[model samples]
Target: MLTQDSMPPSAKAIETAEDLSSIAFGFMASKALFAGLHVDIFSALADGPKSAEELAGAADIPINRIVMLTTALASVGLLTIGDDKKVQNSPAAQSFLSKQTKYDFGDYLRYQIDQQMYPFLLQLNAVMKGDLSDDAIASYRHWMADEEQASVYSESQHAGSLGPGRTLARKVDLATASTLLDVGGGTGAMTISLCREYPNLQATIIDFPNVTEIGWRFISEADLVDRVRYIPGNAVEVQWPGNQDAILMSYLMSGVPGDNVEELVHKAFDALAPGGKLMVHDFMVEEDRRGPALAALWQLQHMAFTPDAHSLSVGWLTQTGKRIGFDVDQVDNLIPAMTKLVVFSKPS
Candidate 1:
């Protein structure tokens, strides 16, 4: 028998085993949450409170599973159920979990399920074998090509625009600025945001041809066609239509090889006009590479998916920027707690 002073060996071992088992089964909770979002359960509850039966009817989920799903989500703090057994969206869930909200992460969850989870699980063997299979390549190609539908891809690109677009408009002295180039600007989100923010800023986005088509559509939809230009070409191979006042390379470099990244940075340096600025926005690992868990995990994911890809520390990036003839300054964090922006300026 286990006592306060000493536990039996069997009891201790069983407790240890149970702890390990729970750790291993952690993904089950994630799958449950993903399934809930995939079915728009949170959105259904956004309008009003409902019981499990009503929620099942509204969300088209099986009646039997409704209670289990809602109870699980409630346990996870995503939903709330009163003593009366009425379930409603929690504050966090209402803000971001519901599809009806602008900040809804439902699409992002769906993208993770459809694009990443299964393939990653299935290709664990190939990944470990260090083989870049055809299927893997095809999946990557499809991911890049389907930005319009892939919420994570679109969200990553939009992340760059969300901060810099607002910051540049408010902080940067744009009246003197004439031309801006958005390198690897996916869907022209940054350009559109910038153009809308700064009337005088003429922006051009360079990306793959297929990606540029989506950018063009966004530009047209935002009525920014007059201010934004689309250049459909490879960012590395093309001569970066030089003499621009500023260059924005948002979330671009981390996906390419380190050498390619260095080369591209040099290319941007050569392309900038006198006194032009280059803005680089991407995940930056801490110098120690121990904390900031997201960056560490992202580095592994990038390596698994892209060729010779890895995130660089901000210290390394600043050093490289200085070496390439740019006066560098670390900009404020865009997403507050996530990533930092590095701003480099060419001499006048």
Candidate 2:
């Protein structure tokens, strides 16, 4: 029944079974990559090309396991192997994965592995029970406070806001605006970008003390110290500075739990003088939440960390702004990549 010619069918079945089995163990591959990064494998490659044994010595990993680890990384296209078997970083690996590059994503990878992986692994439990575990919450709080984690968060925010910010800047005339208040402006990235684009604009960054310290350094480094002032305090509880012509709440309100979002928006409204503008940029999901892969992923990631946090729709924001005595308009799809921008104005 199973002759050599007939064996091809069974052989194919066997191969398929093996592939399925390997897929079941895919987590091992991720763990291997994480282990390599934790041991500074990419950093070792940054200096120059080296063999597996040499890399192990440089990274202080066990000599016997280095070949397997290097082979695993090469298989994943992170490393290139020469005819002589020397290992080197791939082009993409050098540009982004290496620690030396300014756009290096190693910190982001480290954050995911160290801060998020454990809690994310509990997604099933969270969905089944409709709540996050205590351990997950603790890990999330740690992530939010850590500078490395905050930097990753801030960088993602900056990248997303760039297109939208540029579009808004071009559309809205800001030559007359004197002062801007950026609530919860971590690292002053958005505010700095705004100030740099609009030379006449001056801004105040309001955030927690630690974040403000980092923001101050960023502002100083950007040579914007003269234009931007760092205000250290909770944006919600603190009395916002007056005489503001505009306010930017770029990616801030979602972090505030349920009812607090309304309070924060109202506070921003009150801070603005008549005819002043408030810009809120964030990921707003469709009411159905079935599409937009990135937004859906971010929603799950947000829930694992934040209490009473969900992506707000643009319609919801407009209604809330209207209730707070401001005329609201939705800046639909400012960025080709992003979903929504809700701009509210206080009547002069």
Candidate 3:
């Protein structure tokens, strides 16, 4: 039998078996949330609290099934059942999971995590074993080569990215910037946000052909078709449009190969105009390599799908930019605790 003395420090640190089991069964809670989203459980409760029968009627399912799902969701904090016997969405679920809400990112969870990342993680064991073949782990860019997959991924990401893009707009100043190059800009959501924030800003998003094709629709819908455009190609290989007053690369560095990161930074430096700025927003760890749990988890998940993805930290990025002769302007959080934005400037 395993005794206290035999337990590793990490295992011994856990105060209770319940805590350990909760961590082990964490996937069950996630699956409950996914199933709730899949069946529109949150949407059925969006207007107000509903009795189990009413939810069943709204979902076109039997009461027993709805009750089971709602019970699971309630257990996971996505839904709550009251003394009045009505089911209601949690504040977060009502805000971000209900299809009726403006900030709905239900599809990001449904499509990206459920359909893509979940399947990609099945090969994690092989990936961690130093197996780098396509069968073990394919590059994320390779997965996006399929037009259909690219469209679905880009569309979901666009829905999820717009809020962050707006946040980024509020944080960065581009008052005098007339031209921007959004490297690997997915669906032009960030570009649209920046253009809306800075009226004089005209932007270009360079991404894969399939992704850019879908991005045009979002750009058009934002009425930014004239000000924001797409250049479809590999970001690392393409001849970037030069003389850009600013370059925004959000969530791009964490996906590319480790060897290619410095090269891309140098390229971004070359592509900027004199006195231009480069903004890199990504999942970066702390200098000590300790836990900022979500950022570390995101980097691990990215590596499961990417054969050569690099681990990054704010310190390394600051050092790389400084070595490339760019001046460090600022470093701040982008997505609350999950991401950081590092801004560097080219000399005038």
Candidate 4:
């Protein structure tokens, strides 16, 4: 069984003064990073290092203002200013934050966190105390119901999940699997990744109608439309395209109500053909819940807007899978400290 004591060293809670200070000023750091992305600071340095004046010229801002933002960005470890006063992207920033890189995920932070969740988080206290209306706490579902909101969120989510999806494709062996059912498959990110990894794989994605609309565009762009398709509706209520070789639920379990998680796992089990594999990937706390702070924080963020969302744990999922007549095959970190992957197999 997955246990807290066995968690990696990275999962430990903050205990030092530096960590405490970082946590306290975390919002400022987030905004600084967002501001850097907004002004295309990382992208501006993508070509080569530039002086503050050159950066200001590229971004069309005053040199003084550019320096101010760069100071903040440098303090946050995303940028570096050499003794020559030339600014350049840090390795991490250049790889994942700069638009020049194929691995760019700036939209994940820019659109999803900055534009959507950051604003909604202001109501966290009221929602926690039950002072908010049910409609308010469940605004995520409402967002999914609207075309524009769903498109924006889906695009950001697509950007974020693609990296994880690629990582998952490397971790999971689906060579023999010909069919996949991707539950809560936003923008077909995982499906596209899996299809690319396994040439013979054909997948069906189940998600909101509007989300599926955006997903089709992504699938077409990936040239996987013939191999991937979407069934638009809630995964819980919709008729799942079952009898599959594999079922993937990436980032789905945490967004759902606690009571629904077991049912969803059971549904995945029932939908799979005998010997089928089920892979669930999401933000998970340790059994003891001390934390890998990022995982806990993401759960809390979801709770602020999704009142019924579950804070999942490795032990909880292992127990649920075994109880549903599946054998736990493997449990490993999918996105390092943030998300986990639990794989289970049905007896043939």
Candidate 5:
């Protein structure tokens, strides 16, 4: 009865299976992209089109390797091969992947996803076991403890957060709020964006000492040295500034252990003034917790590196806020790819 040929799958089922297989092979596509970034192939083609041989020469790789990689690149729409087989960037690649572009995020890919998170998959089983000593493996906590590692992590993460920061600035208004606190705001990218939008807003960012220096660098780069300040300590234990009208916890909850979330939420509520607003920006998914393939996949990917790195849903957040005596509002598609911003207000 269960023989393979005995029960033929429907067309829809067949298509679903094909899609699932594509998901299974998704790592190959990511690896191919990583390989291209590794060799700075997109930057090599930034000025104009080039033949495989030309790319090989510019990139200092063999022609055969260039041809192979370019073939894969074209498959993913990163590069386009002309009638004469000259390779050039697709619009998407040109804008975000090329090093010369203003909006280039190639470094984020190179350092964060390709370097840091990708290899964590290798220890998926070990991470699931949850037996590794804090110092034994490169857990999120372990890496954050290292100043050098924190620098790389902060810079790489900052690159990816720039676009979202601008979007979030547009979505959340801080015109009436003078003083704001940003907890776990590494490099203060979001704070910089918000401060630029609301010139009257003065903000303080709290993060590890390892990240505070870089956070100050970004704040200075935004020319908001007077408006933005830094607090170096553990977010949960830090003495929160009282009577704050606004507080931001961007990606903080998702990065910490799952069991810590409720306590963190309570801490935030207690820290805020009665009329203050608490904003949470992090990876989230639909109520049913399905789809948004990247967010879903990342929760599992994060499991390999952190104790509880799963995305939190807006509905869950809303109910959580209500349970803690606050009203909840949300703006979806803040990042579109992986982040949603939820706002909580403490009733006056």
Candidate 6:
């Protein structure tokens, strides 16, 4: 029989069990956050504080539900419940959740991440068995079949990438990079961010025709049509324009088959000029794989959705990069973590 001494120490055992339990119930928190976003809680509370009754009426949900959700949101630090029983966006929420802010990412949560990944996870058993039917996570076909679906998903994802794009601009120094090739840059969010940072830097984004069309609008809206250009083509098959100062592949590595990743990096190397940089930003887990829980979970999702593709770690990135004749410059872990920027430089 497993007694207290044989099993484990009571406090340590209880804490470990509680941690595992938290992971299992993680979806509950995600759904709650989604629910708060569904009713546009941050936006509703933007101008000032809002009572549960007011939020319920605005969202067309019951006050009880709003109270519960608001309490959850408050716990997550997305909102602050005041002494008057009124709630308002926390400083973080005001910056990133309120639709009124330029950095608002509510749609990205509601549409791109939650709507896209949640369904596949629901069929975890089938996915793990590698029996996921085509329709479960149709990468290109779904967007190509319907134009509205393409536009909505593309724009929402653009919003999702925008924050990271902005962070990339501020964090990375691109003063000397005059020309850049953005491989599989969806909607030109990162390109726009980089161009805004360096007025003289010009970027060309290569994406599918449908995505490029949407990206064109964003580039034009940014009044950077002259600086940021889009070329419609497949990254792996298409001829990358030669003599580039830098090549950027963001969130693309985790989508393609792992076997093809090295070849793809070689293609970028061939396309770069001497002293050029290659920037790869994507979801990555650490070598240990035991921790960095968020990234590990993301890698698991790729097991379900992306065939033959999975997250790459910083160590793997550096190792693969060196084998391909490039220097590992720096690895950056951006805000909110998981997604990382791996910069590689071609010898001058």
Top-scoring candidate (TM-score):
4
lDDT of 3 by residue, 242-307 (tens): 999999999999989889899989999999999999999999887667646678888988888875
Report clash pairs, candidate 4.
none
Runs off by more than 4 Å, candidate 5: 1-17, 129-137, 309-311
TM-score of each: 0.83, 0.71, 0.94, 0.95, 0.91, 0.89
- Reference-based TM-score, model 5: 0.91
What's the count of clashing pairs in each model shown?
Answer: 0, 0, 0, 0, 0, 0
lDDT of 2 by residue, 205-250 (tens): 8877656765676788889988999787777778899868999886
Against the reference, the lDDT scores of all candidates come to: 0.72, 0.70, 0.87, 0.89, 0.82, 0.81
Model 2 TM-score, all chains together: 0.71
TM for candidate 1 is 0.83
Task: Determine which window of 10 residues in candidate 6 has minimal summed lDDT.
Answer: 1-10
With candidate 4 superimposed using the best TM-score fit, by how many Å does residue 248's alpha carbon deviate from the native? 0.4
What's the residue-level lDDT of 233 in candidate 3? 89
Q: TM-score: which is higher, 4 or 5?
A: 4
What is the model-wide C-alpha lDDT for candidate 2? 0.70
Q: What is the C-alpha lDDT profile of model 4 across 1-348, one tens digit per residue?
A: 345466766545669999889778889989999988888888889998999999999999998899999998898789999999899999999999999899999989999989888988887899788898866765445679988889889999999989899999999888889999999999988898899999999999999999998899999999997899889888888888778999999988888777788999989998999999999999998887877778899999887877778889988989989998999898988887789999999999
**C-alpha RMSD of each candidate structure in angstroms:** 8.2, 10.0, 5.9, 2.0, 6.4, 6.4
Model 2: how far residue 218 lies from native, Å: 2.6
Supply candidate 2's per-residue lDDT for 143: 56
User: How well does candidate 2 score on lDDT at residue 236?
Assistant: 71
Model 1 stretches with alpha carbons more than 4 Å out: 1-24, 112-114, 121-125, 138-175
Candidate 6 residue pairs in clash (backbone atoms < 3 Å) = none
* lDDT per residue as tens, model 1, 1-348: 112233112223336777898768867777777878778888999898999989889888898899989888888788899999999999988987787876665665666544564456555456657786755743334566664544455554553355456665554455667889999887776677677767788988888767777667778888888888888777877767899988988778876766788898899999889999888877776565553555555555566666456577777888889998999744545543345577888999
Off by over 4 Å in 3: 1-13
